[model samples]
Target chain A: MSKKKITIAITGLNNTDNPGPGVPFIRAIRESDRFDATVIGLAYENLEPGIYMNGITDKTYLIPYPSSGSEQLLARIEQIHRKNPIDVLIPNFDAELFTFIKNESWLRERGIKTFLPEMESFMERSKDNLSSFGKKYDFKVPKSLPLTGAHQVDQLFEELDFPVFVKGKFYDAYKAWDKHEVNTLFHKISAKWGLPVMVQEFVEGTEVNVIALGDGKGNTIGAVPMRKTYITDKGKAWGGITIDDEKMLSLTYDIIRKTKWRGGMELEMIRTRDNEYYIIEINPRLPAWLYLAVAAGQNLPEAMVRLALDEKLEPFHAFKSGKMFIRYSYDLIGDISLFESITVKGEL
Target chain B: MRIKRSVAVSENGFVFDSSTGDSFNLNGIGREIVELMKNGLEQSDITQKIIERYEVEPAIFEQNLMDFQSMLRQFNLLEE
Candidate 1:
C-alpha cells in the first residue's frame, strides 16, 4: 500500500515574546489523522512560543527571516526543500507572506500548493486600497488619502479633516507622532517600513472583525464575525466576542468577490450608529480567532487542508450567526504588571 | 468546586446550560467527567476512572484533573 504523504511547513516562527497562533495551529495539525506535519521557523524568535515543550511536530527547522529579496527567499526555501521536500507550504506571518508571494511561482514549480491569492488581487485588497474598494462596493469608507510624507499629510489635514489615522500600508506600523511633531516621524517611518502611508479619517464606532475561509473558486466555506472586547497594549486582540450576523457575512463576501480572494481572509470593519459597516481594511490571511471559528463548528484549517489535498469538499454548515466568542489576552497569563494594569471598559 | 444547578449533560457528550440556554459539544473525556459529576462522584472516583482508562501518569493526571475541576468551578459548570 502506498503511504499517503504530506509535508507541512509553517514559516515565520518568530521566537519573540510576542504571542502567535502557530503553536496552536501546529498542535491542531499534528492531531489530525490526515497529514504528516513539520513546523519550521525563520528564526529562533519566530518559533512559536513553548514549541520546545509540545513535541507535536514530525520535525522543526530554523530559517532566518529573508532580508534581500524574492530571489534570496526562494533560494533559502529551496535549500530547505532539498533536505525535507515539503509538499505544502504555509507562511505564518504577514512579513513572510509579502516575501513568499514574490516566490510563489518558484515554489509552485516544485509541486507545493499554497493558499495565496493573486498578487494583483492582493494589492487591491490591502489597507491602502480599502477606501477605493469601499467606494466600488458601495460601502462607507472613511475619507482618506495615501501619505508619502509629513508635508503631504499636513496638506491632507489642512484641506480634508482632523483626527486622522496614520497607519502602515502593510501590517508594519508607521511611527505615530503628535500633530506638531508629525513630519519628522512620518519621514522616518516611510523610509523604514516602505509604503504608501495610510492617512484616513478616523471613524468612531464599534471595531469588528469578520474572518472567513473560501476556496479559490469562490465558495465561502465558513465565516465568524467578532468584536474585540479587549486589546493588548501591543495591539493584539486579547479578548473578543464572536458575533454572528448575516450582514457581516455578506459584506465580507462582497469584498472577497471583488478582490477575487481565496483562502482565509480577515476583514476589519467598523459599524456606525446607522447600522452600516464601514470598510476598515482587509487582512489577506487568517485572523487570530481562526481557532475559535473551529471551536464554533467551522473548522477552516481542516477545510483548507482537505481542499489542498484535492479531497472532495464536504458540505460545511454555517455556524450560528449570532454566536459570540471571547478570547482573553495570553499575556495575562504571564505578565503580572500588565495584568494588574489591565482595565475592562465595556461589556464583553 | 461544584457544577452549577443550571449545567446539564447528556450521555452523548452534549451539554446545555439552562441558565444561559446555550449548548456545547464536549469531548469523550469531558463527557465522562460531566456524567460522573452528575452521578455525584467525589474527586477521587473521577481521578481513578481517568487514571485507569488513560495513559497519563497518575501524579500529573491528578494535578491536571484538580486544575480542570477548579476551572469548571470558575465557569460555574460544576455543583459544589
Candidate 2:
C-alpha cells in the first residue's frame, strides 16, 4: 500500500542546551514507515537551530509568539496555511498551548486538525494549580504556594520548610536554600515569566519521568517511564534510560483516565525513599526528550497524527526497558544567507 | 541464593538489574559472591568457596554471606 501523505505544522524548535520538543517530534515522524510526511517547522525565533537542520523540516516559517494574543497567532498560522495547508498542527510548548487550545475550532474550520486537551484539562496540570489538582484527583502533589508579590516570601518558610524550589510560572526552577535565595529567584522569575511564581516544598527522592499519550476518552494510548542518569545544572536530563515502572505507569494511566487527556503529556515525579510517588509537575505536552519514548517502541508522534486524523488505536502495553539516550552538543555550521533568509523573509 | 534472571554482573564488579534499570558497583568480595550466585551456587556451597579463597573463618563468612543475601533480596536482585 502507498504510504499516506501528511503535512504537520509544529512549533517549539528551540534546540539549545535547553531543548524543545519540535525537533525530536519531527524526528519521530520522519522515521515512520506508515506515513510520508512533509514537516513544516513553526519557529518563534530566527535562530532556532532546527530551522536550519537537514532532514528535519521541508519548509520553515517564523510564526508570531502566542503571547501577542490568539487572534494574532492565528492570523500568522492562517497565512502559513494559505501557502501550505497543514494536515495536523502540533503545538509543543506550555507557554503557547493556551492560545492553541483557545483556537482549536478556528483551526479545524480551516481543515487543520489538532489533538489537544481541553482548556480545563490543561489548566488542571499546571504547576501552580498542582496541589489543588492532586487533592481533587487523589494524587500526591507537593505542597506549593503561588506568590504574586515578593512580600509573600516571608510566609514561605512559615508554611513550608526551606530547601524548596522557587519556580517560574511557565518555566525555570531553582532550588533555594535560604530566604535570601528565595527572594532573589522570586524577582528573577517574576521578571521573566510574570507574576505568581510558585514555591513548592522539596520532595527528596530519585526523580523519574513518564511520557504518555491519552486518547481523550479515559484511555492511555502509550506510556514510557524513564530515569535521568545524568543531569545538567539547569535540571534538564542530559542522559537517561528507560525503566520498568509499574507504579509510575499506573499513575500516568490514572491521571489520563481522570483528566480525559487528549494528547502527549509528561509527568515529572519523585519516588521517595519509602517508595511513594509524588508528582512534582505535569507538562501538558510532550517534553524536549520525547524522542526517548519513540526509541522505546512507542511511536507517540505517529500515533498522535493517526488519532488526530480519526483513526482507531489500541493502548500500548509494553515497551523495551533499559534502552538509553545520551544527548550531546555539536555545532551544525550554516551559511549566513540561511540566517538572512529566515530573518528577512521569515521562511527558510 | 539465586540472582534474579534479569540481573547481570560484569567483570569489573559492575552490576545492573535490567528489569528496573538500577545499577551499582560491588567490591571484590561482593563481586565474587555475585559471580558464585550467578553460577547457581547454593548459599552453603558459596560459603565454602569464599572460605577457601579468602581464608576467612567459616562462621564469620557464613554470617556475611547471609547478610549479602539479605541485601540481594532487598534490591530485588534475588529470585523468590
The count of backbone overlaps in candidate 1 is 17
DockQ, all candidates in order: 0.02, 0.59
> Candidate 1, fnat value?
0.00
**Candidates' TM-scores?**
0.70, 0.94
Candidate 1: segments with Cα more than 4 A from true spot: A1-5, A15-20, A41-53, A172-178, A181-188, A320-348, B1-80
Give the per-residue lDDT of model 1 (tens digit) for A1-348.
Answer: 333557777653332334555554555566566655555433334224433433644555545556566676677677878877877787766666767677777788987777776677677767778777777767778776788756675577665555566666565433243565355546655776676777767677777887777777667777778777666555556656566556888887776666567777888877764557777777777765666666666777666667666677764656643345454334313443322322221000
Q: What C-alpha lDDT, on a 0 to 100 scale, does residue A242 get in candidate 1? A: 62
Taking the tens digit of each residue's C-alpha lDDT, what string does model 1 give over B1-80? 45666677877888765433345788888888877877788888888888888888878977878887776765546654
TM-score of chain B of each: 0.78, 0.94
How high is each candidate's interface RMSD, in Å?
Answer: 7.8, 1.7
Q: Could you tell me the lDDT of residue A29 within candidate 2?
A: 95
